[model samples]
Target: MKKKLWLTILVLLMGGVNLCHGQSLNTTAAEVADFDVQSATSNMQDLKSNLDEVVSQLYSLDEKERGTDNAISDKYRATRKEIVNVIQTINQTTDTIGEQLKKITTYKKLMLLTYKDIQASRSGMVDTKQYIEDFSNFIYKLDNKLYNENTNTIDDLKLMINSDNIPLTLANDSLVQSMILQLNDLMNNFQQNEETQLETIKKLNDLKTRTKDTIEQYQTEIEKLQQKKNYLLQFMKLYQNDTRQRQLTINNFFESTKGVYDRTVELVKDIKKWVYKVDFDMERKITALNELENDNEAYPLAWPLYPIEQIQTYFGDINFQTEYGVPHVGIQIKAGQWTPVYAARDGIVYFVADNDEIGINRAMIVHTDGYVTIYQYLKKTVIKPGDTVRRGQIIWYSWWEPGTRGAGFISKGANLTFEIFKDGIAMDPFEILDASIVKDKEALPDGYQIKYLRDKYARPIDITNLELMTGTTLAKRENQFLIKYGVGVYKQVAFREDAVKDTNIDKDMVICIAFAESTLGRYLSTNANIGNVGNNDRWDRVPFTSAYGWARAIPVTLNNAYLWAYHTINQLSRYGNKDGNIYASSPINWQTNVLKCLSQIKGYYIPEDFPFRTGPNPNINNPTPETITFGETLTQ
Candidate 1:
């Protein structure tokens, strides 16, 4: 029994040794399969990386090639045509290669080496398909990018050639040449990388270079053409004798070239902006140019009068005084009585009347130049309402009468009043008139001739208060001489008349008053207590001390005159003696009454001291009375 048991133990141990050797063989097989799978994965990765690098380099070369002269010239165009013709061939080759790659059975071998991992085979097939599609998409993108960029570059070049004022410079030509060279380099590089012939690319580059060189030569010739054009312009300017012809040529040049020049500048600006990725639109610039070209024209000046006769009165100072104690502010012409009055220029007749209430019937014409001509003291108007008249065309007839007021009143002789205005303001008519036709006849009246009468006796009229007396009431003072020889009343009448007539009292009446009052010599008071007569003190006391020949009486008398029958009947009212009660007791009463009467007549308002005089003490409140006398009428 012991011998049998020992034999069984030996058999069991031998069986265990065999089992250990089988297990070692299985582990060694697993390690070998794992190493093979790792080697295959690394190989596939390296191939894909190599393919990606090639595609990247090809894409860069294509981009550079597109800007070459070959791309834009006949060779480039022909090459493109060839490429297009062989597109199907290239595509077929690509497809065959793809199919072959797909059928590479290396995946199965790698799977076997990895043992029974079914998922590894499926993963390998997916990776291969993905790589194929990525390469295909990359090639397609490169072709499209090159084709579009080349096409666009050609179009841009064409546009540049057609634009106006394109400068032909070495720098510009050099750009085209450089692009051609770059394109040639790109083609060579592309061939080397892809192992393909760029025969079409080379031909296209040659053709483009030739075309660009020809264009540059033509641009250089254009410099000579421009010089010739400038010479012709200079010749025309020098030899052209006819002013009208010369003017027309200048106008035409400006009108024709201005639009083109401006447009060219704008176009170049937009092209630069586009190159730099700036936002711009060409349509707007084109529209603006068209508008400018259409509206370019010259404005011509209009002559005031055609065949202008001698200017009867040039604009400037005239020898005439107004009833308002002011000198004539504008020019006056002396046309013969009953002479035909014509329009100065083509314009609308703004006014026409048989009477302006200041004695002259006037017709005023307003021209487009903002100038107006007034033909005064007209007997009759030929033109009616809204009548348009041409220069030098008769519109009315001049009428002159003795003892008329303002512009029509002529102390020297019978004459018509003519006046001119610019922009509603009076200007010297002589400046605009034809000097040859209107010979400078007489010098203007001197400043001394415009002196006022009241300037000698009392003082200057208070301009600020003249409007107030129009509505004030009055009371009559009790004095016999004040009622009769109270020159105050008559003097007031003259003052009011002078104010209304628009004449300077200083020029028209001051000198006369001085002669009449003190024989133009200084007067001294007989009583020392009264102060000097010609000085300020005597004049101050005269109002309260005497009812007649008083300095204060001057303004009071002038105010009373406006309320009297003299002014109220002959001047203010169309009907004689419209109001009967006309006397006033004081200057204040006279102002109040005159104001009330004037207000009733025309709703006119008078200033606070309408009839008051301007002086060192114009507004003194002393309860004084004064008087003044009327002198003979004086002419400016």
Candidate 2:
């Protein structure tokens, strides 16, 4: 019956304990321990009662001997006194044991509570430490970015701050607002990041303080419990070793409740296991902020692929519309048909899927930036989860071409699709990787036409949404392989002579820009948006009557009139399209691509391992070759 009662009591107490942990641990471990100890009070009382009964019987025998002391009073007076004294001493021992058991129960209660409290303290400590590390790393990266930008542009920033670009009237209010929006995006993100760091620190400090206090409290309770237990154990041993019968009875009692003792051992074991198993999630909490304020593109994370690679597609902006849904959340970089992709930073590989449902192999590695990088469409991957990789280790190689059924066709041909994620939220990889390194506008084949450009793009018939400009303006051509303009004819064929006269803008720059803009006069649109130098915002065109008219308006006329003077304030090197997307932030890729293409235009070089030589996609064969490598410079 007592065993059943103990089990019921223990079950209820444990239920409350589990409940406490679940519900923010509103009830402290101390409280729950005290409640459980109450169940044993009745058992202790019963044991005391039996002890008292045994002592009372010994007193009754002594009293009976005293009753017969009339005649034998003189003779047995000493014996009677001895019996009374012995009985008195026996009663005192019983009382002492009763008190000791009371204290023992309290000590046991305390030890149980201390065990639970320590686990809680440890959990809080680990959680707080992880959170501190996460926030620190995030804030450090943000600070680094700010330092880089400020150090480089402190003078320019000061000048801009002092300059009076504001309008007295509302005529240029929108323009000023747009400029503010562009600059403030970074500042606001920085401020928010700092505020998050502050909040994280507060949380970390509170948790640390709580953990420390909990440990101190548990230590005090345990010390008290241990001292009391030591005294109580010594007191109990006196009765157990008093006589053979007493020893036998105590032993039997212990044996009877042996199951309860075993259960308690198991309970302690369970709590130990829980302490080991129930780990707090160490995921970075600053992940959301990282995505929101990814203005720190110069985060020192190198590109997975370098100079030859180009970012074919960007994050967000899927379906060519900015309405809703981020279907494509990362960028794709084309390194070549068969080139190795490197790790962005030093980290461990966490996922590797070979011949997955996507048909292409893929790998995901956790980078030091607290984000996971996924490289898909891989032909070969060597590392697996938990394998450490260096910053520039070749983690995988790109496939020959995009998977037929899986990824289908990558925009810039056989390429590696790279993605960065933090706590399941996808981040823009280009924010860390150099977008220009992967996307050099100048690395295009000059004097070459992209064949099957018609087949590659959907026909005008499928462009049902072409509402404003709906008329069919089919292109005309004389030669399909070489330079061919539409039936519209040339308005002004003054490209080479004009380019030579304007020494500030080289022929190579002209050719590279023209080729890169619209695939050497064959854009995706059948209308041939050859000179993709249209509206600064949309790149939408005022359609040209002839290719020469388009070239004359942008490259020839625009350069001569305003842009191409090397000594002038409006140098073409720093000049971008009308909207001012600078082409010279990091000019290695641009200069290299342009110079290489210039060599090709001069029949100077060609790579034997070119992928597009004989397909419907003809090589830009306007007498162009790949004679020069990137390091070579063209002397003007």
Candidate 3:
């Protein structure tokens, strides 16, 4: 029977060798590895239990005859030594052989599962090759441990289990029990590690599948753009330069190019993430992949607007009807006009639109880890599409109307509608915000409340609250302003500080004009002229070395050419050189809008600080610029 067992084991080892050469682990071998050593442990457990029973029985018999004998028996001494030797052997085998085997088995199982996931992805052979190498090494080590190290240990255990050594002393039995308990603990730890690794592998497989789908979608989009461009090229040839359709065709071509470029950029970001995964160690790789998977469905890490006074509407609020006339998809926070809003997380601006019906200014940002945030009803947006924003960076302001009561009379003040999306599905803000809105009252500053009053039109309007105000000197205020809303060249702290100290013009006037003209550098010309300093025709922008250069030149340039501009805020209407020689298309309210922004900065209405007076409306055709203001118009 022993000969037969040896022969069978030899055949299995040979088969395993063949399989290893072919770069695959043998399932029969793995099963054998799992079950083969368990019998040895079980035999050890039985022997230890039997020895314990024999020791108890012998102690009872010895207690009854203790006075009669009174001397140690030679048989008892020999048996004690033999049992001591066996217990020591058992400890050694459990510590070295049992521990090694468990580690190898656990690691092999992890590699196998990961190998299967990689294979199912239909990846190339190169991806599976490393796992195959690992399997081969583990199998070799396991074989050596089983055949070489476990051979003498198993023989010793068998010899120690004879009837002669059954009557072990209490001390010997104690040692045996301790070793068995230790082996069981090691086994439990091994099982837990295996379970954790398996869970991580499952998450990694899901992430790989999602990544593949996203890449395919990008490819499809690029193909569509290519087809559109081809058709436009044919259309352009017929129209030539003389036709009005010529310019339209060129614009279509540019749009197609931009679409392809954007898709490529997004695809590259995906590739980089995959490369990042490959750079980590095996254990770290598993942990990182698990985290990446979780992040894909995680909530936003920051609030869209800080220190909000009230939330008027919550996500999925069925009782309340939003301007869209549908179940609310996001929460609405009531804020004072031009209150600064920040990006919820690090992300690239996906979409930016001005004058939307539901919200005046709207933005949708897509984060790297599968989160998307939407901000609507903004009075102004400082960031542009494709711009990367950091978490907590200012991107826009709350919606408000010009020429209205303290609170926006027409638009109901600044109502910011915020939404968070995970994996393209809307998530309840309360879940993502971790119920902070309800339980975390400390998140809001003291006295943070919106005060309301009735306008001349008998409508409730929000007036500016003190919490939004800042009290500081002019130079120091510019630094805070740049930090809160600055972008492009305007973001340079040292340059802004120097300009504020050196420029003869009012620092607030330059900042307000820059915001009104280019949204604080969002609409700068290639020359970085943030305020569109010189080139008139309204649409053209003159270049400057830096925002500071344009700022310093503001007073000089206006004083030299359009000297009437310094006379009053309305005189600056000639700066843009639009129709009827106005500064902007909405010429009548431009000065008032700038003055209101300045007042918001000062925390009080201070229009006279600019030393300017209102004049006749400079615009030609438009009688009303604020008539169709956003947030007031609710289009679903």
Candidate 4:
């Protein structure tokens, strides 16, 4: 019995020793695995940061070129090339990391090893410090290399700029002109390069396959270890004569193992957070670069629509006969019913409405470049006055209308009226539109050849309604909103109210003018029934204009408002105080100046006796002092 007892004790000791050894091996593996993952994550992050810094530096150099001498511009170009090389290297590294992540099975093995090391540590096992040191050194080397490369690139840039025969393209132009162009070009290129770098960073951050798989594997292993530990505790308790001793050992093991698992989780969380930060930062930088690029004078047009079809009429010198025997100044095109009308350029919808009152449905867009386009006789508009429309975006649709006079004209069906203006003066649109888009059609009933207009068709009023009614007031207040919504009825009021306290203009005068023009929103009728009265076709008349919740008016009316305001300001400045103040005693001055402004503005809209009407018309009612005072309060 004594011999058996001794043998049993020996066997138990041996078993414990074997378990400890195995656990130690596993622990070592786990630590190595953890180090590998962390190393890769850190390397990728550093690479991304370095690339971002390079982009930022390049942008700065480009900005400097704008005001600097030709020598400085040349220096910037050379530095840009070196930075490009560094970017290429970073991209290569990112690709390597991505490839490694794809082999998830290997990563899983590494994770398992890390878990084992943690388990072994609980048994008082210790790993060599050399492993950790080696990893730290590896990361340090990469960082150092990146730093040196960046420094060299920057120094080279400075040298190039200071050297003779500056290689800058700006050196070829007049000194000042060359510098300006170089600066602009640099800014554009910098933005483009930054965007590309951001795309690459996004790709690297997206590498999740291996990481996810490893996480899952660690979870499975942890569960299994927990079950084993529980079983061992239960078995030891049952066999030990001294329960306290057995309990203490089991508790210690539990604490140590849990600590290891917890630490692993924390590391993973940190890596994820780093990736998110890097990604967000890159995005922000890209946005800034884009804004900088847009500030250049030769900035490309925001809207660059290619004509889908040919123009049927050219703007200017139109010979169409009106009911009163007056000739028109705009051109007209024949198109298929429901054909999409696109903005000729990125601009605000100036007017959009059914021409029923005038026997046509049309849409118009006003550009920041002082150009305006009109698309007449539309079935529907898809954009609003204040909406910032993109290039080539469909603004409205066209529909067929019956011809009033000639035989061939009647067969033409749907026709589009197109017009262009520069600072309120009508100009031929053919010069701006690409000629290849125009198609030749049969001669008109009036024995005239169809003129092909080159400008893009503007959206009529229906689309403007959609834009104004779709969003909250706050969203509509953004700069993009101003670009989309041109100066129209409601918008005009908003603009005036906002500008009332502006030192540039008189608040009372602006309010009075708006009241006279639109009756402070009371006279403006969006309901198609009351506003559009001429054509019976719902799609062809103002009555058919979209009743969107914001401002229900044709796009053309807003355009006219702009024309009116421009003329009003121009004429008023000629007579009254050019300081923008209007006094009660200045009524006569206001009237005279207003008449002159109207005469100028009306030239584009009407050609016959435009300044003098045949019938007697009453003067616009002036606002009382009380009403004007209240208007001032609203602006305040």
Candidate 5:
């Protein structure tokens, strides 16, 4: 028996060189066939459980076919039938693997789209929540601004009434005449109407309260939606895990075939070596051909400002001035006038200075990572020293000579000088800002919007709030203004665009109001009061703490008047006067003056005439363009 076994083994190695040698994965795939989901798990599990028995059956079939004596046809047929059974099981398992692959692919796409939807919805909800927050904040802000104006005016008016300024001097002008007539009327029926005016005050606060509730409704809905989105995302992740397990099972099924296939190839290789046909390491060579796919790495940074000049000044070396050798200390980023500069990183403002000598205003900030980001040539710095600035916060407005031909600019457009310092050494910002190293813009797959993980997760600690508003410190007031970036910043709200979108106020009205209130921001020249005026009646905006905050308050008050009093313009006369607000107090010449100011601003209505003054007629119940509430006209 030993002699027989040795001879058999030697023959096995020496013969069967004629077996198929050139094998392909596709050829093996043909043998295995497609997979189906149902019964697939059982099929693979059965094959795995009975693997040894299946192998023995296959060898028995081979031996029956290659036997020396007159073969027993019955035994051969039985052996063949047993081998066919094992093959059927394998085919069923392969078919199951195919089904799993298709299912996994479908699931992957579904999960990807679901995750993307969640991401998109979350981003949008965050923005909507902010709008709701702004609406809520605007209410108390409006109340505060209006209350201060009203109380201060009443105090002065009481003093004047007791003093000897009787008849109110030269009260012949139509506006003043109207006021005097109302004052005389009030003197007679003061007690009767005081209750009515107080009722009006209640309605004002009530209207704001209702608006606040409406905003809260939006908040509630967004929160619920956010929760639902999160749950769906979690379900998708679990489903993906299940699919990955199925994939591993399929790979296990593949491994079973690999062993048998390798044995067959080994026989061929032994024969080839005996014949000296070839000497290749087929396993290593074939394994090398399998390509491993890599997951994509996201681009980690972004451009500082959205809209900027195409050609950015290189960071390392540059000459801003050849003759003066101005030693360009940083990269110059060119953007148009009123283009707000955002904080590139979360930081605290350290040093702020207006260098009139160099015609440059700069704000220096120290970041949490010990890097210092310096912004130069700023038109204005909203935050003061020690104020924490959030990433993407609008810290400064671009310094640009609007309506003038200026020098030292690219394409005659002003540039913001940006620099980064680490360990007291200036570093090239392009090293971080440029996405080319991580992945070039063109290199990204088609229809892909690459977003940084950092961008998604990096959010600042909430320090921009009423908690900082002590109604005293200038820095604290400025901090409050800075927090309301979209509504109060120089660029985003340069013309108060955010408020205009959510209110009845228009750009034309803002320009006019700013001109009327602060002489178009000139009042801010001494203090931080913008486009405002106080005739000791109802125009002082002292409680706001900053010009930007004061400017934002204008729209809130106008919208409130539209909602509560149904009046479009300001009124100071008695309760029944529709045009009784401050706008009507300028002797009807107010419109002409407002027109002049509106025309001077960059974008506003022509100064041909004042459009919304329905003189002596109440402003409420009149839905005219530029005066009507946005709700009454086109919904913005």
Candidate 6:
């Protein structure tokens, strides 16, 4: 009966804990939703204000033009000047509207980023809540077990003390007193355990409450952004419509003014036909401005770094447009942290640190003829505004810490965001930048395109840059092949790095030959004979002390034995048939397998070896060249 009662209490406590978590989760979700609504409203208010300013300018222009029409007949000469003034005002207002639209677009992107932050925060909260729930459950189960056990022990001791029908001697009396003390101790321990559990639960509940409060603040921000976004959308629609109508009005006035101004010029010219005709230099400033604009195209910019590991993001990416409501304005070069950032062209520093509010540390260089290059997410800067820098000069260092304010949330690791702008409008950096330094660009065959063998091999698959690639990335790629094929010789060995460091042979050729020789050492004898050198008996094998020992020996063995026999796989296959200088029993088969593995290891995917499987799984004790033929090869 006592156990049944305790079980009922346990069930009630479990239900209470669950109820508390459920209520807290629901409240958090609601707050996040509310934040979105408020954010949208705020955006709308800003848009509405900008729209009003544009509309007012349009209205004032319309009134001015209308007034000029009213006095045209009575004061035709005086109205000519007024018409010129109205035309100039219209041009200025049009520029103003364009600037306003750019601001609205920027705000839209900010709101989208806010939404991403809210989602990340909510995910973190869910994880924290789950931890608290599990912790509470463990504590509750322990508490229930202790309570039941202690209660039964106390009841049994009481029954023992009450048992009678014997003399009350000193020994019996002392024994009863001892039983009473034991009961008291058990009760004290039970009470202490219960208190400890309560304290633990209390601490856990406090942690949960603190977590919720922090997220609540974030949710509040989200709500404001959501409301602003909604409000902005409404105003954007109104602004678009208003601007369209105003544009038409301004266009009509422009044409009207042009015709009137032409007639007025002709009338005045006849009246003062012989007046002093001094050639004015009115176009001097305009000519200078035009020259500056054209200069941007004449001189192309340089790449900030050579052999870039990857392009993280490109200009005008569709994904960027969907997330930010505007196309990306720059290219993000994936580079290592602290890598030097160079100036794209010869230019004066315009801004050493712009867009800091978004946590982007950047530098802008104003190049010749109105061209500007922006480098963002830099760790350190060495130049200040107004300092002139040459093309390819070091300007800053790259940043790559993820979750840091410096790198922002979207960009994960070390990268440089490079942008080119001509007269304040963003241009594609790839389109305008010079490509002389990127040798990999010209390495691909006419019809062939670059592709990754796997996402893990993050670098570009350019044979030219293969040796120049980072050693760690190269080693990781080589290790994958070794691990997958269960190659005993090259497993956990830096074969690629060592081969490149020790020999002049192609990295791909070395790895391919190893695969063709022994499935990358999987079938090698315990001696770790990678190349099967000096094993002329076909089934024979040479030995090395260790995998690294074999790695060091293969490059030397290849250079001495094979370099004279063949420089290329094609030549080697044809010559392999020669009696004494032969490298394989079936030259054609050897060539086919080597080339197949060669292409795969060089950033292309291929299926497993078929037909006669020489891999470790089939348990081939020894895989000879004659036994591993792809098929009956054609006689050449």
- Per-residue lDDT of model 3, residues 459-495, tens digit only: 1112233232364644455556666777755644444
Candidate 1 lDDT, 1-636, residue by residue in tens: 222422433443344212111111121222222333345334333423433333354344334445455344333343234323223223333344333333323433433343333234334434543543444344333323212343333244544553553344323544544544543454344335322112322333333333333333333323222322233323233324354553443344333223322433343343334321123332343334344221111111112221122334434334333322233433445555435555555555555555433233556554553455665545566686455554434566554332232122222333454555565455554445422222122332333112222222232112323332222222121122123222322323223333323221211122222223432223414321122122331234222344223333333333332322122111221221223322222224333443333322222232221211111122123323331122101000
Clashes counted in candidate 3 amount to 2
Estimate, for each residue in 1-636, the C-alpha lDDT of model 2 and write its tens digit. 223433443443344222122112222334433433345345334433444454455455345434555233332343234333433433444455445445545544454464465455546544544554454344333323212332432244434543573232233434434544443454344435544444443343344334434444443333323322332233234333434544443343333223222432343344333321123221332233344222322234556653343456667646622322235666666755446567765565655666433233566665444466767767556576656555555667665432221222222246677777654456766444433222233442221113113211322112222222111210111122124321222211223324334222333344455554554565624243453344333334456555544554443332322222111111222221222223232223433444344334433221111111111111112212221111012101
Q: Comparing 2 and 6 by lDDT, which wins?
A: 6
In model 3, the clashing pairs are: 407-462, 573-583
Q: What is the lDDT of candidate 3?
A: 0.45
- TM-scores of the models, in the given order? 0.21, 0.24, 0.25, 0.22, 0.24, 0.26
Sort the predicted structures by TM-score, highest score first: 6, 3, 5, 2, 4, 1
**Deviation in angstroms for 604 in model 1?**
49
lDDT of 4 by residue, 1-636 (tens): 223432433443344322222111222223334545555555445535544554564565455444444344333354345335435534553555555444554645654554444344433311222332343334333223212333322244544554664444223324433444443454355445444434433332232334554444433333322322333223333324343553443344333323322433343344334332222343343344344221221122221222223444444334333221333335556665445555655555544454322123455555544455666556555565445443344666665433211101111344666666565555555445433233232332222232222121231101111222222332233323333332333334334434332222323333333333333345544442222222222323233343232222211121121111221232222232233322212334434433322222222111111112111111113233422321121111
* Candidate 5 whole-model C-alpha lDDT, 0 to 1: 0.40
Candidate number with greatest lDDT? 6
What candidate 5 gets wrong by more than 4 Å, as runs, is: 1-303, 318-329, 355-358, 401-412, 434-636
For residues 124-214, write the lDDT of model 5, one tens digit per residue.
5445434434443443233222123333222444445435643443222334335444433433343334334334333433333333333
Which residue runs does candidate 4 get wrong by more than 4 Å?
1-313, 316-318, 321-326, 354-359, 403-412, 440-636
Reference-based lDDT, residue 17, model 6? 28
Candidate 2 lDDT score relative to the true structure? 0.39
> Each candidate: how many clashes?
63, 7, 2, 38, 18, 27
Ten contiguous residues minimizing lDDT sum, candidate 3: 627-636
lDDT of 2 at 245: 46
At residue 34, give the lDDT of candidate 2.
43
